[model samples]
Target: MTGAMVTGAPETTGYGGTLAAEAARFAALGWMRGTSGNLSVVTGRDPVRLLVTASGLDKGELRPGDMVLVDEEGTAVPGATAAGKPSAEAALHARVVRLTGAGAVVHVHTVASVAMGRRRPGGIAFRDLEMLKGLGRSAHDEEVVLPVIRNSQDMSVLGDRLEAALDPGVPAVVVAGHGLYAWGADLREARRHTEVVEWLLELQLAEERGR
Candidate 1:
């Protein structure tokens, strides 16, 4: 395909718009400060194409233009006028989507997530919280474990580690000393999982302090 070739992306739809809005909101909360996080939403499934944030762009300033459409292999669609490069961790997003049948994925570097992951390298479990309902967990004392894997730069290695550690039932994974990865059937559900997991970690921190 020629460099001038343009691929079809969601122009009329607001998928990118929603991601940008959430990126800005998370930036305000320091979840994605300094462009430390990445977000993606699947645009097409037949050829497995998704819109991922560009590498090194400030999440606070995240906009649709900062997103690039890429296929499952992390290659930019042949006919898209995409100027931004897909995130370096796009492979991870691809894995999450494929493994979980997710339509969207979110990765964020939040203090509480990093802290909790570091504290429990294996994983952390939450229970007795009403917010657990957000994850489809019973609001009673049922336990929900969010998997944690050691942080690694090699996408292949990290992918393997995540595959082994991830709990299929959970919507997110914590990267020790790194951050969290959340996904769902769509952007709205993915964002909800991200928010709920982050909230649980923050609450855990507060509760630990009281001890």
Candidate 2:
């Protein structure tokens, strides 16, 4: 929301610790490359403040300093110096937190997720998979629909559409041709959701190919 500034990596007590550790893990798995995905943690709730990674930093080498402070409106906060602007998709993260009471959000681009999202008019459907339980199902036969919405360059439109498309009871959604947005009550759950959703997407693709 304002001119970005610079800061050092964050300490172990906060979001910096999670980002520094998790971002690289996702990168090693080939999920984040070319600085393509964004992650955030809700640092404050009343005013909706967050520590979001600055745009264009390689996730493989994310550091605490690489994170920026921003408000619910996605405006850069006065402190928590930043090396770059928050990711362009920061608005989507804010929306998820506001709408879902999510404490952390993870967005990533992966091939299977992108391909599946592209063809699903409303959303992608998953069923008869053991992984459904990772999304909070009681039975393997349960169905989970990962909602899909058209991707756009306009944050306002994307934010609005994504909000309307979201199911807070679920873990993730798809921004068509872009990728997956996953969240949880905390950073650990959010990370697990992202991993499980990604695995489900890849498995769905593999099964279809086998068929």
Candidate 2 per-residue lDDT over residues 11-101, each given as its tens digit: 5345676776788888888888798898888877766877787898899997767887778977777755645789768877888888888
Poorest lDDT segment (10 consecutive residues) of candidate 2: 1-10
Candidate 1 local Cα displacement, residue 99, angstroms: 0.4
lDDT of 1 at 210: 84
Top lDDT: which candidate number?
1
Per-candidate TM equals 0.92, 0.91
Clashes (candidate 2): 5
The weakest ten consecutive residues by lDDT in model 1 span 1-10
Candidate 1 runs further than 4 Å off: 1-6, 9-13
User: Model 1 reaches what TM-score against the true structure?
Assistant: 0.92
lDDT of 1 by residue, 85-170 (tens): 87779988988777777988999999999999989888898888999999998978688999999989988789889889878789
Candidate-wise lDDT, in order: 0.82, 0.80
How much is the lDDT of residue 79 in candidate 1?
A: 59
